[model samples]
Target: MMGGPSENPELWAFLESLHCGEFLSGTVTAIERFGVFVALDDGPDHPVFPGVGFISFAELSWQRFEAASDVVQVGQRVSCEFLQFDTWNLEARLSLRATQPDPFQVFADGAAVGQKLHGRVTKLAPFGAFVQVVDGIEGLVHLRELAWTPVETPSDAVQVGDEVTVVVTEIDRERRRLALSRRKGSSEHR
Candidate 1:
C-alpha cells in the first residue's frame, strides 16, 4: 500500500519517510544455487532480488531429489509472508513455506480443502513435485498442473527450493493426499 502525498499529506511534509514490514505477495523472478529472487507484488517497480528467504536442502520437502532444478522453473509466481524489511537493502525477507503455523495447532484447527496457500518448491520427481504446505505438512503437485503441456521431466519446469503459488485441489485425511496447482494465467509464469 503506497501512500502518496495526497493520500497521506504528512509524508510529503516530512523530510524522511518510514516503512514497515507488511505481508506483501510476490512472484519468483529468478532462481540460483544459493537462493531465489522474488519481485515484490506491491512495491516500486517490483525490484527483484535474492535474500527474500532461503530454503535449505534439508528443509525443502519430504521427497528426495538430485538437484534443485527438478523442483522449479525460470518463470513462476510465489507468494510469501513477509518476515521483515531490510532497511539497508530495502528488501523484504519472506518465508516460502508456512513455518509460523504450528503443526499441532493446524491439526487441531483442521484446515479445510480448497484452501489457497503459498509454498516453495523443495524437490521434484517424475510423478510430481513436493512442496512444504505448512511447517510439518508437505504436499504434491502432479506434473499435469505444473504446466499446460505434458512435463516429460519435472526438472524442465521447476527446481528444488523454488517459490510458487498453489491452490489446494484435493485433501484426503485418511491417506494424506494433498494436491495443489498454480493459479491460471499467471504473469510471472511463462
Candidate 2:
C-alpha cells in the first residue's frame, strides 16, 4: 500500500507550514543518479512519495565528486538548509552542502602565489590544462604558463592524468579560481 499526505495529516501539516531557508534534519532514503531523496523528520508526508525532501546533485556537496554516494549514503542522517517547496513534486528542495564548510575557502585561506605544489592534470583544453592540487580543488595552467617554450595547445606540455608540479600564479578567492604555472621562470612562476 502507498502512503501519502491524506493518510498522514500531521506530517503533511508540518510540511505545508515549512518556509524557505528553514533548517531540517532527515535520513537519506534514496540516492539516484540525479539526486538524493530524504525522509524528513518532524515533517509531513509527501503528497505522492516516501521522501518529503530532495537534494539535487549540485547541492550534495561543495566538492566535486563522481557520484551522489560519494557524499551521502542511504540511511545517513543529514542536516540541510531548506531551499524551497517543490510545488510540482510536492517535495522540499534542500541543500545539504550549505550546512558544511566550503573546502574552497579552506584551500584559499592557506594558499599563496608563487608556492609550488604537486598536482594531477585532470583535463586538457585549448586554452589550458586543469590540475587538481587537492581533492575538489583545481587550478588552471594556461597554455602560456604550460612551459617556458611557446606552446600552441595545452597538450603540447601536459596531458590529462599527468602528475605536475605547478606554481601558484594567482588566487581569486571571490571567484574561487587558482591560476597555476609550469613555466621555469615568470613573475609568478617558481
Candidate 3:
C-alpha cells in the first residue's frame, strides 16, 4: 500500500507524476547488498536515501548472480522500469531488468518440446536435478525421468556441475517452467 506523499507539495507532485511500467533513467548513487539506489534525473531529491529510485536484488538482472555488485556498480547510468512507489521509504521501486531483454522469452521463442539439449546439472533436490539448458534458463529433470530404472535420489544419478543431455518434455511460458527428461534423451542414460 502506498503511504502518504512528501510533506513538500513539489515532492508530492513529482511522485504523483510517476506511473508503474514507465521507463526512467538515473545515475546509480549507491549499491547495497539489499539493492541499488539511483538519483532520478527529473525527479525531486530523496529525503533520506542517496536516490529516490530503488532496484531490488531480484530486479537487478535476468541472469543468475551472486551479488548486486556483480550486476551493477556505483556511478553507472541505468534505465529502469518503475514498479511501484515504496511509500514506507518514500522511494520508487524500480526494475533494472525490465529495461533489458528477457533471456527466457528469447529462449522460449524457439524452444520446442521433444528437442534434445545438452546442459549441466546445477543443483540436486529430492524430486529432481536442475539443469541449465541455457543462460538464465534451468529445467528440472524429475526423479522418475532421471533414468529408465528407479532413482531414489537425484544425487545418485547426477551431481552439480555434471554435464548431461536431456530432452525437453514440457514448457510453460506463463509460469516460466521447463521440464526435461534424462531417460527420454537415451535409454542408456543412468
Best-to-worst TM-score order = 3, 2, 1
Off by over 4 Å in 1: 1-110, 183-190
lDDT of each: 0.58, 0.85, 0.89
How high is the lDDT of residue 138 in model 3?
98
Model 2 agreement with the true structure over 1-190: per-residue lDDT tens digits: 3345676666556667888888999999989878999999887656566598999998988888898988999999999999987655677899998898888889988998889899999999889999999988999999898988789988888789999898999999888899998884344433
TM-scores, all models, native as reference? 0.41, 0.81, 0.93
lDDT: which is higher, 1 or 3?
Answer: 3
- Estimate the TM-score for candidate 1: 0.41
RMSD of 2: 4.0
Q: Write the per-residue lDDT of candidate 1 for residues 1-190, one digit (tens) a residue.
A: 4344464343233212323333455566666776556665554432234433334444333344566556545556655555554443444555554434434345426665566677888789888888886765777888887876667877877788887777778776666567777644234545
Q: Could you report the Cα RMSD, in angstroms, for every candidate shown?
A: 16.6, 4.0, 2.2
How many residue pairs in model 3 have overlapping backbones? Answer: 0
Clashing pairs in 1: 68-159, 68-160, 69-159, 71-158, 71-159, 72-158, 72-159, 73-158, 121-161
Off by over 4 Å in 2: 1-16, 19-21, 184-190
Worst 10-residue lDDT window for candidate 1 reads: 11-20
Give the candidates in order of lDDT, highest first: 3, 2, 1
